[model samples]
Each structure stands twice: as structure tokens, then as C-alpha cells.
Target: MMRATTAAAILLLATVAKAEDSLIEIVTREVKGCMDSEHLGSIGGLRSYNDPNSAEQKCFLGCMLKKFKALDADGQYSAEGLKTTIQHCPRMKSHPDIQKAALQVADECNGKVTGCSDYCSCAPLAAKCLHEGMKNKSFQTIFIALDEALDKMQS
Candidate 1:
């Protein structure tokens, strides 16, 4: 019985490690696609996130979405996809789409998103913007609070 339990534990560990690795790969690929399609090597607009004024963060996200939509018309936020993603990510919260994409991964594969899917709205191209946006703490702070407010309103 001890040996069986040990083997099962090892198997679970291996599975978890593999899942993490797969999620990383998926994120990397998606981000790369976003960067390539959008021609956005780096965003100069996101530098003010630490300045205490959270407005820039919101503006940056909005601008990024427009640019992304222009680059990949197929990736446009459908009314349904936007609603679902918003429901999952709650837009008032900073990077709602980014949060949605991340949560989409969590939802689709037990916290491991290996590829884009119906739930995960961030396509190969849009994921890059999300990854970049998340690095700004100011944005996160405002976004999180906003998410709480929005969630409450919705509820």
C-alpha cells in the first residue's frame, strides 16, 4: 500500500510539472504571436503605471486592444466572447481581457492552458499585450479594486 501511494504521488507530481510546462509554452507562443502581428516590440505607453495615477493603465489597455484588433481582425472581441471574458475577468478591473485570458487557461485545462480555446479569449497575438500589461503594478492595483466594484455591481 505504501508503494502504491508513493507511485501515485510521483505520478501526480509529474503530471503537475508537465501541465505547468505546457501552460508556459502556450503563453509564450501566444505572446510571441501578438508581438509579431502587432509589431509591438515594447510599449512606451506603460511606463507611468508606478506614478500613482492609474488612468494611464486604463488608457494603455484600451489603446492596445484597438491596435490588436487592427492587426488580427479574427481576434476581435465578439459580443459573446467579450461578455464571457468580461464575466470571467470583469473589465473594470485593469486588464479585464488579460485576466479573462489567464482565467480561461485556468478553466480550460485545470489551471493549464496549452492552447487558445473558446473560454480563453486571448489569441496567440493578444496574449502578449496582457503579459506586458500585468508587469505594471499600478495598473494591477487599480484594476483589482475596479474588478471588485464591478463584480459587486453585477451581482
Candidate 2:
């Protein structure tokens, strides 16, 4: 009985470790794509969450959201889909604030997104809209919060 329990525990630990690694890989790739794109990268870069704000930053954020598939083909709210995509992420899965923010991002951003090009323009209108959406207490903050939570959990 003891041996069986020990084996099960080890198996569970391994699965969790793999899931964490997978989350890191997925986020790294998505962020890299957003930062590396000719259009997005030109606007400074996506290398850090902290930097001087510019019209370009708003546009790049929109681009990253799209790349992450947080929006639909018609650029509509798809929070559920987005949630599903990161369901396995340990930090997000365990945090209620993160979950609420994840779902709200679509609500906050959808109405203003006329199209991908709208973000590209970085027009005052578009930037204002995205800023409003970001202020709603959610998705824009997820990456940093989730990263911190994960690190805390590990340590």
C-alpha cells in the first residue's frame, strides 16, 4: 500500500512539472511572435512588460492578443476559448482573480476593436479604447501576475 501511494505521488508530481514547462513554452512563443513581428517589433518591443507607453504599445498589445487567439475570426470576444487555452497553467488555474481577469479581457477589448488594422493605426480612438479596456482590472495584467504566482508557488 505504501509503495503504491509513493508511486502515485511521484507520477502526479511529474505531470505537474510537465504542465508548468508547457505553460512557459507556450507563453514564451506567443510573446516572442508578438515582439518579433515586423509591425509590432517596430513599436519598441514586447521584451518587457514595463516600458514607456506609446501608441505603438497599444497596437502591439492588440497584436499580441490576436496572436494568442483571445479574439475570434471576426475580432469578437472569445474569453472562454482563451481560458481553455491556458486551463492547464498552474498559476492561472489556481487563482480566482486571474480567472476573472482572463474572462473580462475580451469584454473589455472587443467593442473597440474595429479590426486588426485599427490597432495598427494606433489612432487616439483606438488607443483610448484599448486603454479603457485595460483599466477594467484584467487580462493586461495577467502575464505578470501569473508569472509571479508561479514563481512563488515553485519557491
Candidate 3:
């Protein structure tokens, strides 16, 4: 009987560990997909934010805001819309840290230079400010409860 019990416990532990690993895999894959070559133009890639002044970096951040629905048609901000968009990222949508970082990005970088007269300003300011607010490491680490981050971001 003791032998049976020990075997059962070992199986349970293995199952739990496998589940955790799977969860981490899902989140990592989903987030990486966003900045893949296809979408890098919009969302800054790994370390792309380090040089916030570059035109590519600027557009990267600005386009990411647009993609995330943080910016509306007129370039204004909508918290609700932003939340909706963030949900696309598996496990990250409802995370408090992500919400805080996103809000910071919205408040400070949303319209930094989005006006028509200063169209060029939008990219640099948005990218720089957003990069400062949302680091890649923070993004990966915030969604601790991998199960919660299971939903794939809407395409």
C-alpha cells in the first residue's frame, strides 16, 4: 500500500510540473510571435527599444500602440480598447503590472507627437516613452500565473 501511494504521489508531481512547463511555453511563444519579422515593423523587437531615437524604433512603438488599440482612429487614447487589445497576449491581458505599464504608455506616450502638424514627433516620442515604461523583461516576468495567460492574442 505504501508503495502504491508513493507511486501515485510521484505521478501527480510529474503532472503538475509538466503543466507548469506547458504554460510557460505558451506565453513565451505567443509574445515572441508578436515581434517576429512580420510584425517587427509595428512592435519593437528584442532590444529595439534601446535606441528610441531611430525612425524604425519610433514607428515600431507608434505602430504597436495602434495595433494594441491604445490609439483610436484620431490618435486619441481609450483605456477600454487598450485593455481589449492587451488581452490578445496570452496571460498578460489581465495582469496588473501589464495594465500599469500600458496605462503609463497610454498616458505619456499615446499622443506624444500624434498631431498632424508634428506627425514625425509621434514615432520618436511614443517609442522612447513606451520603451522606458514597458521593458521586455517586465513583460515576460509579469504573467506569473501561466494558466491565466493561456488565451492567445487576437489576430
Candidate 4:
């Protein structure tokens, strides 16, 4: 009975390991597809973010962008990228250019952000907002309009 129990445990462990491996494979393939897609722009920009000394970091970030289509030229940043940025980058933001790029990418995933209104669903509007903000334009006009429309919310 003890031997039988041991064999059962081994089988269970092997099955769990196989499941994990399959998940990794699926994720990697998805990322590869996104990276190779023509819509996705040059991944050269993102390549700089990964630590040169850490192969794992490099692979992880690359896989992330590729899987989610965040590097797409036409602003195809996947829901994953936006969710990640909104959750993580708010405090630990990096280079200005990267921040801007991240915002732009997040704009592409506007639909996924919880509580983000439908009015801001379109990418063009979000792109315009990000572009103008990045350009150092005083958002006075927009701020005033929003303040007036939603006075308490602005506070």
C-alpha cells in the first residue's frame, strides 16, 4: 500500500509539472506571435528596459510586450500592458520617454481600465491626450473644463 501511494504521488507531481510547462509554452508562443506581427513596431525601444546582465529580466519583459502586442506600431498595446502599468508604474516610473511610451500603450488599452469611462474608449482621443501632455502643453483648458463639469471630482 505504501508503494502504491508513492507511485500515485509521483504521477500527480509529474502531471502538475507538465501542466506548468504547457502554460509556459503557450505564453511564449503567444508572445512570439505578437513580436513578429507587422503591426507591432520595432521592439528596439523596449529592449533597452531590460537589464543587460540579467537574461531572465530581458526575456521576461520581451515576452510580456510580445505576448500583449504592446510594441505594436498602430498602438495595439494589449490589456495586460495597461493593467500592469496602471498598477505598477505609477510609483516606480522610469525614463521620461519610457513613461510616455507606457502611457501611450496604456491608452491603447483604455477599454480595460476599470472605471475608465466609455468617452475615453477611442485610441485617437487617448493618443491625443498623451501626446499633448508629453509635449508640455499646459492642460489648463482641459482641467478647467473637467473642473467645471465635475467640480467635486476635481478635488
Candidate 5:
């Protein structure tokens, strides 16, 4: 009876892990498709907020934000959508402070970029504003969490 219960628990855990893996895979595929469509190379270019100032990089960031529903059709930022995207990652959801920081950044960026004519122009400004608005420690913490999540996924 104990052996059967142990097996069941293990199986349940595996199923949950698989579901999480699938979610990540789906998001990755969608983001990759966005990159391909935008003719963007090396997502690494977006590691720094200032680095995405180029036209192509700006378009790529716009593509990603749109794909995640963080930027609406009218070139406006959605704080709720951005927060939802961050919370979608289990590791990110574990850090409530990160979510709050993200929302604050989104709100500030939204104010800066709301009047832009298109996402390409809006996204870069938003990125720059977000970078400026976020606390250094919060920014580092978010980046570290992202890096750790990526490492775990890769491994």
C-alpha cells in the first residue's frame, strides 16, 4: 500500500512538472516566432535597456511586448498584462516584490509612451523609462531570477 502511494505521488509530481515545462515551451515558441517575424537576431541584444534603441531592436521589443499582450494595439502599455506575463513563470510568481516592481515600471513607462504612434517607437521609450524607474536592486533581483529560470529550463 505504501509503495503504491509513493508511486502515485511521484507520478503526480511528474505530471505537474511536465505541465510547467509545456507552458515554458509554448511561450518560447511564440517569442521565437515573433523574433523571426521581426528579423531580429540574438535576443541577447535586449539584455540591457539602452541596447534596444536601434530600429530593429526596438521592433523586436515591440514584437515581444505585443506577443505577451503587454502592449495593446494602440501602442499603450497594460500593467495588468505585463504583470500577468511575469506571474506566468512559477519562479517569478514566488517573488511578490518582483511583480510589484514590474507593475510600477509598467505604469511609469506607460505614462511616457502613451502618445506614440506605433509600438516600434513606443517600446524603446518604454524600455528606457522602465529601466530608469526601476530600483537597481529590484532590477538585479529580477534579472537574477530570470537567469536562474533559464538555466534550470536549459538543464
Candidate 6:
């Protein structure tokens, strides 16, 4: 009975892992579509999160936030939406620290970009806040994954 239970646990884990991979793939495809639709120049040309973003880059970031439902209809940062997004995204879900940092960033940036009716302006501010807040945290891998995803889309 113990051996059977162990085998079932392992199988369950494998299934969950596969599901997470599928979720990531679906999100990546959606993001790639957004990039193509937005005519984002080149992922390589994007400035660092701390640097000032060009209009196109800002719009692209906005598109991403919208696709992920991190921003509300009015282009405001939605903490609840962000939490839901992180919970569903395997990459962010697996990293509790990242999840915490993201929420904190949302809290800090809340209402700070008020009156920005478009994501192009609001999303960049929120992203910069997150980038700065997580600079000392162990979140580099997430950014690296994003870079890799964008690179793959380029090809």
C-alpha cells in the first residue's frame, strides 16, 4: 500500500508539472501575439526597467500587463488582479518571495499613477516600481525567463 501511494504521489506531481508547463506556453503565446499586434520594435531594443522607456516599449509593457490582467480597464494597477495572475502563473507561483515582492510593489505604487487613463504610462510606472523593489531580491531568474521568451518569439 505504501509503495502504491508513493507512485500515485509521483504521478500527481508529474501531472501538475505538465499542467504548469502548458499554462506557461499559453501565456507566452498570448504575449507573443500582443507583441506582434503592437508592432513592438525589438525586444533587444527595450531599455532596462530603470531606464526611461520609449513610447513603443511603454505600450508593449502595457499590452503585457493587460494580457496578464495586471491592469484594470482604466489602466490602474489592480492588486487583486495581480495576485490572481501570480497565483495562476507557475513561474511566479513557485517563488513565494517573488509573489510577496509583487504585492508589495503593487501596494507601494497604488494610486501613485492615478489619472493615467492609458496603460502606456501607467504600466511602466508600476513595472519600474516592481523592478526597483525586487532589485535586491532573488528574482533575476524570472526576468531571464521573460527575456528568453521574447527572444524565442523573435526567432
TM-score of each: 0.25, 0.45, 0.39, 0.22, 0.63, 0.67
Best-performing candidate as measured by lDDT = 6
Instruction: Please give the distance, in angstroms, between residue 142's alpha carbon in candidate 6 and its true position after superposition.
Output: 6.3
Candidate 1: segments with Cα more than 4 A from true spot: 1-24, 43-77, 85-155
Per-residue CA lDDT of model 4 for 1-155, tens digit only, reads 01111111111011113444533344334434544543343333232221223333334343343332332333343445444533343221433444444455455435432332222122323333433432343221111211121232223
In candidate 2, stretches whose alpha carbon ends up further than 4 angstroms from where it belongs are 1-25, 35-63, 73-80, 86-89, 115-140, 145-155
RMSD of model 2, in Å? Answer: 11.0
* Candidate achieving the largest TM-score: 6
lDDT of 1 by residue, 1-155 (tens): 01111111111011113344532343234334444554445433332122212433333333333332311244343334332333432222354444444344323322232343321243322433333333331223212222232233334
Q: Candidate 2, 150: how far from true, in Å? A: 17
Give the C-alpha miss distance for residue 48 in model 4, angstroms: 16
Error of 6 at 55 (Å): 2.3
lDDT of each: 0.31, 0.42, 0.40, 0.32, 0.53, 0.55
Instruction: List runs of model 6 lying over 4 Å from the truth.
Output: 1-24, 47-53, 136-138, 141-144
Per-residue lDDT of 1-155 in model 3, one digit per residue for the tens? 01111111111011223444654454445444534633444332223234444554444434444444544555454445555544444434335455555555555554453543221235344444554544432442111222123232322
Clash number by candidate, in order: 3, 0, 2, 3, 0, 0
lDDT of 5 at 101: 65
Query: How does residue 118 of candidate 1 score in lDDT?
Result: 25
Residue 59 lDDT, candidate 3, scale 0-100: 44
Tens digits of lDDT, candidate 6, 70-110: 57877787767765655665445555556666566656666
Pairs in steric clash, model 2: none
Error of 2 at 47 (Å): 7.2
| Lowest lDDT 10-residue stretch of candidate 4 | 4-13
2 or 6, which is superior by lDDT? 6
